[model samples]
Target: MVVKRRFRQVFTSLKEHSRVSYAKIATIGGFCDLDLIVVKATSPDDLPLPDRYVHELLKIFSVSASSFRAFSLSFTRRFGKTHCWRVALKCLVLLHRLLRSLPDDSPFRSEILWTRSNGLLSLYPCHFLDDSSSASEDYTMFIRSYARLLDEVLDCLSIESKEAEEDEVLESLPDKMKEVGRMLEVLPQLQSIIDRVMDCRPTGASTRSFLVQSATKHIIRDSFICYTTFRKEIVMILDNLFQIPYRSSIAAFGIYKKAALQANQLSEFYDWCKFAGLCGSYEYPFIDRIPQIQVYALENFLNGMWQLTESSSSPASLLTSTMESPLSSTEDDSDKQLVIWEKVEENAFPRKLVKDEEEEPLLQWDVVDNGNWEDLLEASIGPCKASRNNLFYHSNGYGNNMGEYGQGEEANGWQMQLYNPYASNPFYQPQT
Candidate 1:
């Protein structure tokens, strides 16, 4: 009974601090080879291996395991609709659930807890963007935490400790970790799936307004350059496992092979112009605009993934705000959805640098080589272009005048769902 109560408190502490700590690692951790970023509060020498931190780490591990487990189990079946974005969401929810589980003999429950603003600005982009070292930290913390949790749970259940032992705990970590790596590798698949689904819906040419030829180019760039980075991280994680010898590596070996096959599909994006049907002549370079809506979606999806890896010390406010509301918009009455693309020729960001304001503008990036999609990824992050991803035009929170557009969630249910993950205003109060 004592253990359970203390563990409850211990977990609560973990939940609170882990939120900020995890974010730190996710953002800054990537720069340093994906190792776990242990943001020491006060000094590490002062705290040592405290009980509260142990319990919290345990919970974070269990949460990461359970979430990825679901993705692994679901992948051979139904992961496409939202696998790219959906898998990350499922992981965060599972992380929250795992932090709450506890056992009675919580030895380190009374350890000192701490927090600070330094936790932020670490810029943990998200798990997908984080590299092998940061990913390894997530793996290591998860294993250590799981070992402790498993031991405690067995004791509480009155099951023979011998029934479930140390080696078993250690063995479980690699499989769970590798599974997560595999799932994340497939994150880029979101674009292809979205494309296929939208394409399945017919478009009546008559109802279509302003069919932009450049949208295809934008999608291609996003698919290859942006999505490939995600896919590459997944491969890096899986490949890194080969360095660590474990039984789980055997299980992951097959998964790695499958991930490899999925990776092959990405090559098709190199010829995105062919698939998006953007081969026709254009007045401007059509393939370089930032797909702001899609990128925004990727950012939110990554944010949730990092939350799942965290130790659970964050408040709901930070978490809630991280889940931004979508831009509000009205739905077009047309039942047909267009698998149309947005133009990159008129990108608004980085304000095209021009020495000679000549009528025939110079291609700034000078990317005439359109043979591979990887070249597109070489183009760094810049300003956002106008979005067709969400139709802010559908009267989301717009005034009587067409110029006054608002993306308030209350004004448009559709817009709210899309923006709920990336915007910062979901927690904002609605005007009466």
Candidate 2:
């Protein structure tokens, strides 16, 4: 009972501090302080910690988990949206570190806890963008920090000895492979977040907008490049595994095959984005847009392994086509042209109209005599026919001719003032 009360007090203190002090929430002094208390209590009794007491401590950590969850959800809410962005990101960073700090023997060392914690962290950008108050600087910083965390995690999981014998390396490969797969699952989410952040505008006008925009573009481009690098490293590790005797290499080959397939898919998606113009020139380049040569070579090597294992024509046919086709041929020039044309059409009219009006007319074709055209059209057509969807028209069809000229004693004298060809049309309109 005393232990329960003590844990309650500790939970309350940690919860209170998590809200205000970013530094304190991140340190061992925060929740880990409570962990020490629980550990010490068991020592004084000279007995193994009661399962009930340990459960109570888990419950306390659960509260910290809930706090992080609440912080993430609060980002989209109207109240404190601006202030919550930094707080929530900080909490996630701290929680990620805290989870990593748990002893190997701790109950929380399981995959479930890590997944729950990392899943919340992965959703940071989805909520971050939902908040209207988030600044570009916040997004830039969040992305950089998230990337750093991933790098650290990967660095920890990476195998050091490149020349180690297959048996020696295979012992550690399973755990390392699982970690890589888990981290790979998070890449798509990170890419999606970076894409959305790039699409977001700064909340208000500021001199930093250009810099923020540039920084975000670079971050996204660099992140994708980093993902490709990590994939290459994984493939190289798999290749080392394949160098062993055929009997031992079979299981490793299976993992390698799957990784190769996924790498192909990721590369294709990146290419689609680049060709579709979703990516900008500020970061994405025309030549060597996606680093897929390594992916292609890895894929071919896996396909050869599959041919050997299954005695199948499928892998042979796939390899033949892959070798025959140029990477650019995958996305047809006609489709690329169509996509470019569609974008041009969408931005062509109003933007062109605005620019033309600002500059002095240089050619006969450049000058548009809207006033005279309207006068001629009005003389030809009497009054605009009323339609149900027309805002100016009424159900009884009486207000179809309503305009500045139709309002007063001038109504009878006004000759249904110059019928505006653009008025009835929704697409084109001359700016007032």
Best by TM-score: 2
Off by over 4 Å in 2: 1-83, 99-432
TM-score of 1: 0.20
Give per-model TM-scores: 0.20, 0.27
Residue-by-residue lDDT tens digits, candidate 1, 253-322: 4343444444444434334435445444332232332333323333332222122111222333332323
Task: Please report, as a residue range, the 10-residue window in candidate 2 with the lowest summed lDDT.
Answer: 335-344
Write candidate 2's Cα lDDT for 93-196 as tens digits: 33344344455444443332344355533433233331222243455455345534433443332222121223455565566544443443444344444344
Among the numbered candidates, top lDDT falls to: 2
**For model 1, what is the error of residue 22's alpha carbon versus the real structure, in angstroms, after optimal superposition?**
48
Supply candidate 2's per-residue lDDT for 137.
48
lDDT of 1 at 93: 23
CA lDDT, every prediction?
Answer: 0.30, 0.35
Poorest 10 consecutive residues by lDDT, candidate 1: 108-117
